[model samples]
Target: MADRLVPSISLKDFENRKGEITKQLLDAAETAGFLTLVDHGITVDEIEKQFALSKAFFDLPAKVKSKTPHDTKSNNGWEYKAQLRPSTGTYDQKESLWLQRGSQWPSDEDVPHFKDTTTEFLDKCAKVSNQVLSCLAIALNLPDDHFRVANDPNKPDCLTQLRLIHYPASENAVGTWRAGSHTDIGILTLLFQREGEDGLEICPGRESHSSFAMGDVFTPLPAHTGPIVVNIGDMLMAWSDDRLKSNFHRVRAKDVGKSPSRYSIAYFNQGRRDFVLQGPLKKYPPVTVEEYFNQAVQRNFARQQAATA
Candidate 1:
C-alpha cells in the first residue's frame, strides 16, 4: 500500500472556489484515475431514499424483475444474476437495472410513472455531470463550455446508464477476488455506493523502472457516505491526449459473516454517437466514433479471452 492517493474533495470547497478546486481535481485525475467527492451537495436523505427504492425494485419477484431482461445489444434494463460480463472466471453474482436518458418508461396502469423517481435522480445527476464537465474543460486548459457542446438538450444522445448493483456475500471468497478486472468505456463514470463491504481495489501503476515481478500495486478504497466517486473513462482519456488515465479496478466478493452484502448505483456519462471523438487539442490526430467503438470491442474481446484462459 504505497499510501493509496485517493483525492477527497469537499463540496463546500467546490462551491466556494470552483475554478481553483477544478484545477486541482484535474491535476489529480491526470495522475490518479479516481477521486472521492465530499459535500457534493446531494443530501444523505436523498441517497437513502434512492437506495430504498432500488432495494425495492431489486427485491421484486423473479417474474417481475425479469419483465425487462438484459438486452445485450441495447445494454439497457434489468440484468439478473450471471447475465452480465463475468467477473474473473465466475459470474458477477449481482442483479442490476440500467436506465438511459430519454428511454421509454414501462407503462402499466397500476405502476404508472413507475420510473418517476429514477427520472428525478437522473436530472440531479445530469446537473452534477454538467458541472463536472465544466471543471474538466478548465482542467484541460480549454474554455469552460468546450465539452458542453457535446450534449444536446433538445435531442440529446448522451447515454446515461444508471445501474443498480447488488453483490451478495460469499463464503469461499478469496482476499483479492473481484467481479472482474476491467476499465470503463465512456467519458466519465459517477459511482454512488449505497453500501459497500470493503472489497473494491484499484490497481495503480508501478514505478517506470520497476520489474515485472514487482507487479502493479493495488489499493483498497473503502466506501464513504455523501461522496460520489468519479473515475476517468477511455473516451475521456483519449480526448485528453492521454493526459488523464482510465484506471483498472475490480470488486471483490464480501466475506461471509464478516461484512454485509453490497449495493451500488453507477451512472455512466457517455458522449453522443455522432460526436467525433478526436483528441481535445489540435496536437493529436483525429479519431472517429466508429474507430473508437471498434477498438473497444477488440479490447473487450481480448480481455474476455484472457479471463477465460
Candidate 2:
C-alpha cells in the first residue's frame, strides 16, 4: 500500500491569493486527483448537528424507514445495502439515504431539527463547492464562474446530491467490500467521515492507466475531526479535457474485529442533466449528463444481477 496523503488546500486563500491558490489547486487536481479543504466556512458545530440528525434517521425502525424508499426515477430517498459496483463486480456493504434540493421528503417529525440542520449544512456545502469551482475555472484559464454556473444545483435538471451512508459491521466481509472500487460519476465530491476510523482508499493516477485490477497499491484517507476531503469526479475530468483525474477509490473494513459500523456524508455536485459535457479544450466528445448517468446506472444493475445469479 502506498502511504500518501491527499493535499490540503485552504479555502481562505480563495479571496486574498487567487493566483497562488489556483496553482496549488491545479497541482493537486492534476496529480493526486484529491485534496483536503481547510478554513472552509462550514463550522464544526454545524457538521456535528447534521450528523446527529442523520444518526437519528438511520436509527428508526425498519418499518418506519421504509416510509421513504429509493426511487431510480427520482434518484432521492433511502436505499438498502444493495448498490452494486461494476468495477469490482460485487455489492457494497452499506445503506444510504440520499437527499436533493426541492425533492419531496418524508416529514421530519421523528428526528428533531432534522430539516433545519440539514438545510444549513447543504447550503454551506454549495457555497464551498462554488468557491472550489471558481478556483478550478481560473486554473483552466476560463472565467471564474464558468464551471460554477455550468453545474448550478438550482437548475431544474441538475442533480446535486447529499448522501448519508451507513456501513454496518459484518462477519463475512472477505469477498464483499464496504464499497467496491469505482470513480464517482459527477463533478466533485465533498466527503465527511467519522474520526479515528479508517476505510477510504484511493488509487492515484489510475484514470490514465489501463488495467482494471484493484491495484494492491492503495492510499487510505485518514479520518480527521474537521476538513472535508474533496475529490474530482468524472464530469470535472471531462470538463477539463482530461487534465484533471477522477481516480478510483473504495472502502475496506480497516478493522475486522472490535470495529463499529461506519458513517459518512458525501455531497455530489453534478452538471445539469441536459447540459453537454464539452469544454474549450475539446479533448473528448460532448455527452449529456443524463446519458452518462443512465448508462452508468444500467451497467451497475446488470453487474449486480449477474453476481447474484
Residue-by-residue lDDT tens digits, candidate 2, 1-309: 232447887878568877777888898889888888889988888877777777888888877777877887877888887687766676688888888887755567867777777888888999999988898998888888887777898888788899998887666665346898888878999999878766888887655321234456777788776789899987788778878878889888755464467888999998788877776788767788787677666665776677667
Clash pairs detected, candidate 1? 87-179
Task: Supply the TM-score for candidate 2.
Answer: 0.92
Query: What is the TM-score of each predicted model, taking all chains together?
Result: 0.86, 0.92
lDDT of 1 by residue, 1-309 (tens): 423477876557566688777876787677777888776677778776677777777667877777766777667878766543434655666778886766544333324345776677777777777778888877888778766666533246665577878766555665535466666777778888754456677764522111111225667788755678888777777788777767777776654444456788888877666767666565456666446656776766665677678
What are the per-model numbers of colliding residue pairs?
Answer: 1, 0
Query: How close is each model in CA RMSD to the real structure?
Result: 3.8, 2.4
In model 2, the worst 10-residue window by lDDT is 206-215
